[model samples]
Target: MISAASEVFSHAGKHSQDEIALILQKHLKVDSAGHLSNERRISPTRNQWKYETFSPVWGAPEGLNSKFAPPIDDLKSIRGVRGIPHQSLRSVAQWINSKIIPRCHMEWIVSSGALWIVQLDLEWEETDQGKDPADATMVAEGLRPISTASKIFKAFTPGDRTSWPKLKNLEDFDFGTTRSGPRLYFATAEQLQQALATSGPLLETEIDELTAGRAVLRTDLDRTDSGILNLPRTDTVDGRLAVAWLRDTLPLLSERFGSLSGLAVILHAFLPARAAAWAYFDPGTPIAYVDALWGLPDGLQVLPHDSFQVDIRRGRVISQKIRFKPRFLCEAPDGTWRYTEVLRLKGRSQVLSHEEAIEIGLRTASIAEKLGQDAQIMWFVGIPNAYGVDANLPWYRAREKAQQAPRSARRYRPVPVSKQDDLATLPQGDVMIRLDPEAPLIRDDAFLDEVIRIAQARKLPVELQGSLLSHTYYRLSNGGVPVVLAEPYSKYFRTRGRRVFGKLVRDRVPVGIKAGGEHVSEARLASDDALPGLFAKLVEEGQELLQSSDKDSQVEELSDLLEVVRGLAFQAGAEWEKVNQAADRKRETRGGFQERRVLLETSLPKPQADAQLDPREIKLHEFLRVEETGSFASVPIAALVSKQGYASANFELDGQPLVLTLRLSGSRIELRLEEEPSDETNQGDLFSAA
Candidate 1:
């Protein structure tokens, strides 16, 4: 039956014997009386119980201690008085006498894997209520050697242990029951005050407020025992003390508790790793030191992926090795320090590292120390190459060179020679010579024809009679060319002749006469004798006339006269080698006259040629032609002067009254001088000798 039970036990894995019994009792039909009666057949004899106790004596190692013996006979002697089987009696004795409870001095192995030995340092406060023996034993095992009950009593009671009275029962003594009573500890008030002197009275008060009057117990917590402390623990006072120490030592961390909480929230939200796998704490130190170590302030939070080293001494943080990179510097602005999966180079080549940043801070401090209040400091981060340093550097000179180079390379090829030659060609048109009728007959077509004749006679290169005479009858005697001639009293002659002729018939004086009568009507004869001399006189007279006119009028007249003189002189003196030279020189200095003449002479083709002159020279020549003739020579002077009071009958000439009439047509004046009957020179032969 026992083998069957063992076999069942083996088959059922970890099932209990009770469970097997229940299964058997439920499945198999057995009377209870019979079951009990059958159990006796399978049982060992009465001596076997004693043999069970003695078996270790023969099979155990030779030197093993035998202190585990049970007091079986004493239990049996007591149990025999109460009726039972002998084997049952022995079983009862073995069970009752077994070493179930440990001795007070023996070491015990804790369920947490730690070995604990009972020490003499068990400390307890005497109370009206007795201490539990189990609690007392646990405390003894946990405490150090010097924390014994007697020493604790002496320390708490303020008396010598030998002098304290011994009581028959602990409950009889009138002792305090509260745990708040004083106890022995290393951190005394005086020592605490001395240690906190530099931190000022506030810190001292804080420390005192946190720890004062509290009973302190010392215990060494070792990691080998899996003894670990967390932020929250069963000992509220100790936990609060730890928290207060952190807060006081690291004020910035306390201030940034919200940031830390936010980081925790982010971690929780993302769950990048196992929940609650890591923790953070204040590394009690100065803010500057923290800033230096972390390359920033305590507020500069980070999302580290693994275990990290926080050295309170150096105020530095070093993270553990991790496959995942630090995704972000949590305190930086959004996106500035964001993580990206794309592989890229990072570190010193990327940005300033924490160490470099701290070194920069130190250098900055040194510089600030030297520069004092005048110093200004600025900080920047990121790859140096990412900035537009090179792009922004001045390129003014380069730009200027670039701009100028293209312009300079644009070659300015000279205008084609053919185009220039084409431009140089004379233009074809009529050359109109505007004549002033009042101008001397020496300036008439007769003179003009003489000039042409001379030019022809000399075979000079010139265009003659090709010129158009304006403001007069068109006449040139040498070739019978149509010349403009002025009527005796036409507005064209009357207006122009008034200045030299005055208001009399004798006013029509000949040219070359200077306010004198001998030179009258015979002016053209001088040219017959000496053409050059006559031309000299004419030029002199023209110059005087030009000078006499109003400045504006004089410029105009002089300009016109220069054109005519240039042409005529060129013709008359064609036989002379210096004629063209003189004409050209005069043309060059004659205001804008010569330029206009050259232009017209070339462009108009003497009313015979075919090509046109250049426009610039044409404009100049037009100005010269208009200037040579005074404006309005064809307008009658009498129309300008009052004629209302003049006689309406026959007019007289040389004091002889004659029948005559006077009339005006447009700009012309008409006068009729009739013969008067006279008894004097007209009477035939009366005074003549027979």
Candidate 2:
């Protein structure tokens, strides 16, 4: 009924809240006193009525009961009874606001063919979640539900201290052998200080908006014996200790990050045992690179971990490599965790399966998609479950650091290709196997098996056209001949082939002159007189790198360009240290180009000119004079030579040795040929005199 009212009067000022309530009351058969009228009842023949019926059928005479049944007024009244729908939620919310009860979890029921308010509780009843933070009191008085971890936190914190709000729920608060991980909470500086009154061995790390999360801290409070000692304990690491660490570390971090306002103090309940994973994602690509280790991710700073590449778009594991496993972190018998040598498993046993890695990649990709930026995610693979500890939007470092130069063409482990004769015996149809062409494909039985499974599930012929990114599709013909069809193969082949050749050329230059430092060096470039020319070449390469669409070419070109810049810096008698300092000063004031902001045109008031001038009357300086005979510059070449720091230079004019000398004539310098009597000069000494 409220939906009907909204649809009837959607425009602003067309109807007031009172008008809507009155309309609802009339339709729902409510009295002026807000009590439901005694004109509603469940139909006696409700069993015979259609179980599921639309609005139109509900209003019909016989639709409420059996078809042959006589019509009843109360039956029709049921159709007018009101309840919340998508469109009516807004109207109901407005009505709820006017109620004397400020906060409630309400229930509405259709009774005697009229809608009736059956229940109204002052607090959320859990039948369904009410509004987030149902009332202001929830925030002002800390009335919100406290998870087990948070309750433990409150016990340690002072009663008069600030309340540490729970950022998220601790999925499991009991420290059990099967526990996956701890719950995370957030606190302010005051709350953290209160919790830090009692502290012990704790792990500390700094965090800001741009950081990629930190390791979970393990403290004495997280010990299993704490529960027996009647002390507050958490299944995960003690949040109090984590908060204390943040309080002490925050000031130090502020020096580097420049501010504490943006810092979010997070406390994680420590989950013991098992392994951890971290993933890096780029918005431009459909892939996420993941690294996993046998121990806590805290060791990621120093230890080598297993790497896997996942195709986020298709949730497929594109490539994976298992590295040597020397040790892993696990729960010690004393309820603390430490690293131990990998005695149980020899070689590199996979920390996470292909499925687990793909799931992490997909989740990371979803976060990046929603945020519209790149992201890094960290997770813990614990007993029977994987916990996502943190997600972060990594700081933008495109201009802050130089990209690693592309070294060599990517080498892929060759996969067995089907021969034409083998293809001729296969089914004939179309099958799509989402694959990354550049990904290593050797010994991946899962990939090939999956393809075959998909084909068999689709019941396609043996000869089928397998499709993927820029690939050659094949199908068997009736005559047992294999027919091949490439969908835009040339496009990818030409581009990739050209990039390989380009990289070879780009790599060759830097490697050849890199040795002996003689071919290109500060000393060589100092007197070589080609610094400006090399600088110009750097500028050209920079422009090409920026404008080109090929990513491989850009990397190669940028590396070569940076080499030239280093040489130019050396020739200028300035080390990279000075250059970096100057760059920092300029960047601090002028800013970098990462914003991609373009200045189209500025709107400013036109300046008032004192006078106007005409081009015809203005006398221009005669830099050069030409009367269809020859040209003569007002400035002497000898002056230019001296200004250019050259005393004398040898040049070839019309294939003749011309030695030009810089001589002082009055206040100006003039260029004069060395006194040489030769008739080959055409005009002899006259030419030299002129």
Which candidate achieves the best lDDT against the true structure?
2
The stretch of ten residues in a row with the least summed lDDT in candidate 2 is: 32-41
lDDT of 2 by residue, 530-632 (tens): 5665665565565556555888988987887788777778777889999989999999999988754434344654788343232232211222221221222
Model 1 misplaced stretches (Cα beyond 4 Å) = 1-327, 330-359, 370-378, 389-690
TM-score of each: 0.12, 0.27
> Could you tell me the TM-score of candidate 1?
0.12
Clash number by candidate, in order: 25, 14
